[model samples]
Target: MAATFNGRLFLKNTAYLTSTGFKVILAYSRTTNFFYAYYVLRTLTAMICEGSINCLALAYVADNVLERQRTSAFGILSGIATAAFVCGTLAARFLSTALTFQVAALVSMLAAVYMRIFLEESLPNGENLTQPILKSGQDDHCQDGDLSRKAPVLKKIPSIQDIIGLLKSRVTFSQAAVVAFFNSLAEGGMQASIMYYLKARFHFSKNHYADLMLLLGIAGMASQLVFMPLLAPHVAEEKLLAIGLLGGIADALLYSVAWSNWVPYATTIFAVFIVCVPPCLRSIASKQVGPTEQGKAQGCISGIISFANIISPLIFSPLTALFLSEDAPFHFPGFSILCIGFVTMIAFFQSVLMRGPPPVSSHKISCNSLVA
Candidate 1:
């Protein structure tokens, strides 16, 4: 349904990013002082674009998934994404040296064609474009998360301003942006640096680490399917987020303590935490925005995440190199992770304490305010 659309869109875009990044790097035959930086920026730019597009996919689904089933729906969506990730990793391991970027691009293009031809639109005519659909409790044809059918068919594309206006909606957009920023900051550091740490510490080969990641992905998928659906319905979103923060902090600390190969076993539990949090973040945001706004909401929130991913590595790469040197200050990154845990705990408390926004002045605040 909607989850399928979102998952497919995200995966296809990721594949596109992979191929495009390689193409760019290959075209630049002459390596310069800025070559590595240029490569990093280009690769990240493609990833950010993919992340932004995912928001639109998320928005398509939020309106359709019932409160009771949303958690399970998200789980299924995540499962598809992880499975695709494993496949892509395996494909890259085997075919990267043999196949050119053009071949990868061709495969993606064919997949896109199949989706365009066979996949049904979830939303048609944008008939449900208006707000208040959530309030009305309509079960309209919400599968596939395509509300495009509900919208008018314009002969011309929208202007940049029109798109910006969609992103500028204050209520859900602002909060989504903030949450995305935090989530990405945490993930970029956790994922990128951990692999480096494992390789440096345990004399592990890149291939071995990839295998480890594959196993972690499988475990993560299982944990999400078992836990998220069952807990998301009963637990308050803020509390769920708080608990996840604690889990992530514990995961980071646990990694710092990984003295031997046995340490990765503990690391797997932390991987489960990483896999489970994003959906919770999405579900909370989905509940706030209506169906029509889902695209903009997902885009903006994801944009924030993209922004974080873009910046954090730039800031931390040097720190990791400088402080977490081969000999000295090995514990700085671990301490930094501990600080993230503390900051997140405080933020979660504030979120819970606030629960909802302040009461509006009837004459002052416009009724259009969605978050309020």
Candidate 2:
């Protein structure tokens, strides 16, 4: 929908979620019975309002930023996200549960309000550069040049055909998609099983989790904001991607063999580089399509990550559980994490084989601008 219409236009509506979030928070404070229901409602609301918000944001960057500067632009965006994560984690440590919720809700609302006021449209004058031409009699719902009867709502949304078309368009795009899938698979697996493994092995509590996350966030923020912007100018995105994947492999493998509690914490030094992988992938992908196709391209990649997020736990969670159980054939508590390292290794190998995407010409950049 953002590819066909406009992404920036929809971002302001995410503020609506802040109101619903507060309702859930209030429900939590008052009654336990309705809290889950409210939280579920909020989740559903997120699906409606902000399901593709991150993709849309990436698409906007692809549209406005020049190709030469895109990797750094993406790195900066990621850095901001990491910085926010660090602040949020630190804030949660000191605040009461309710106060944390209140602060979070207000911050979300304020961010959305700011976007509404100041955000510029990447797709100029509501002209969607990427909209497909409709064949005559292709759809009864589409009326040419009729503002009142443009098309059905479903036609605005991307379909399986859209992703397939994108994948077939560029071989680099396809390769990047494969790399993204395995990387996200490892990430989703980590989310499902890593903390439990730490808890079982080291008797780690919530504070320990907070501390580990803080260390990762701080280091990752510096790498994205500081290291990537500097390195992206000097090296190719494919190389950066390969380096980041190596970091992922190192982080996972180090954790798998953690001899003591300090070893897991020490692994943060390697984990910091893992955060750079997505930005490098996104930078490469943005070059595969024309200016008009940013939303479709980014959306397709985001869909791959979403699909991986859905299925990874199904594959790894049980594996982790089985390995941790006393009745298992293997004695390694870190076996599942080692499996995640192997998954990262797969992505790293793919990245090593990948080459740099062809650079966009300065002439094309100016002429093919999303602006009319």
Candidate 3:
């Protein structure tokens, strides 16, 4: 809610400030003769606010949902978010930026109200949510601590040592973390450049971008809702991860080299497979640890993704700006995008090294049923 409110205010302020010729000096780079000012201010106003929610939501699903059913649950979650994105994009097409943001703020406020009123706490009465940070078998010595009692206050904020311990303890966890980092890096780099590339190459307007996103959202929704549930149970998550990475690599390559407007639309075929990546990775990561460790595991994955978000723009944005400029040394305008595809290939190779978790069995009988 705060993000939405702040975003709306920022948009309004930016318009007013720009119209009034107001600019703040962020930096004066001597090498490029660049005046990096207003854009930096604009970026600061729009913060990444979804990290905590994503971590908490995935952790909750991991804790409560049956292991065998987690992929479908996560897929459904992704589908719902995609549907919401479609709706939001469509709405934004017709609405002014300020009004659109205002509406978003209002929607977020309502969502907060609803969650507060209806959402139930997932943790059990005696379970200390904070205790799991240290109790998740990451450290053999930590396990010696009393499980019946709450964790020490210091344990709530996980130390660097705790994270290092997790990374060292589980090979699967480490592999999943690598897959997530490179996957997110590729995604972020693509997002940072794609819109600008489209606008520069095809002279795309807002409606054109909206149409593209709509198609992607529909493809993603179909894959998550229909294909994922059917395929996840039968296919190994590791193989699915590899397939998704391969699809992403192709998608990025296609976008980078697209000569005609229709080529971008054609890449929607790859979206179906690409959308499967996150759920597969999440399912694999979730299986790497016991129930007590779900939060920590998912939190680590989310943290890696956040780091990718930071690193991606730094690497891709300047590359994109350089390649798109008339002063570019190379004639290939798609060089930056090709780099993104290559980054995705790195992730594909990482996925290739992963061993799938053993198949789960649902045929075992409970003790009460065995007695009967």
lDDT of 2 by residue, 10-101 (tens): 64355354444645465246477567666776777666654366677787787788777889999999999899999999898999877887
Candidate whose TM-score is highest: 2
Q: Candidate 2, which ten residues in sequence have the lowest lDDT sum?
A: 363-372
| TM-score of each model, in listed order | 0.69, 0.85, 0.76
Order of quality (TM-score): 2, 3, 1
Top candidate on lDDT is 2
What is each predicted model's overall lDDT from 0 to 1?
0.55, 0.76, 0.70
Better of 1 and 2 by TM-score: 2
- Model 2 CA deviation exceeding 4 Å by range: 11-30, 49-51, 124-155, 362-372
The digit string of per-residue lDDT tens for model 1 on 258-346 reads 66877776567666666666776676555544444455455556666777777767655554555457655555534444444554454
**Comparing 2 and 3 by TM-score, which wins?**
2
Off by over 4 Å in 3: 1-50, 96-98, 124-155, 358-372
Deviation in Å, model 2, residue 76 alpha carbon:
0.8
Among all windows of ten consecutive residues in candidate 3, which has the lowest summed lDDT?
1-10
Q: Which stretches of candidate 1 lie over 4 Å from their true place?
A: 1-48, 93-96, 99-107, 124-176, 326-333, 336-372
Instruction: Show the colliding residue pairs in model 3.
Output: none
lDDT for each residue of candidate 3 in 1-372, tens digit (9 for 90 to 100): 111112222322333333222122312221222234444544543343335465556666765677677788888888888989989988988887556755665665555556556665554222212222234222222223333333222224456787776777567778889989999999999998899999999999888888999999999999998988898888877888899899999998888889999999999999999998999888878776544566567778888998998899999998998999998998888899899999989889988998965444322223222122
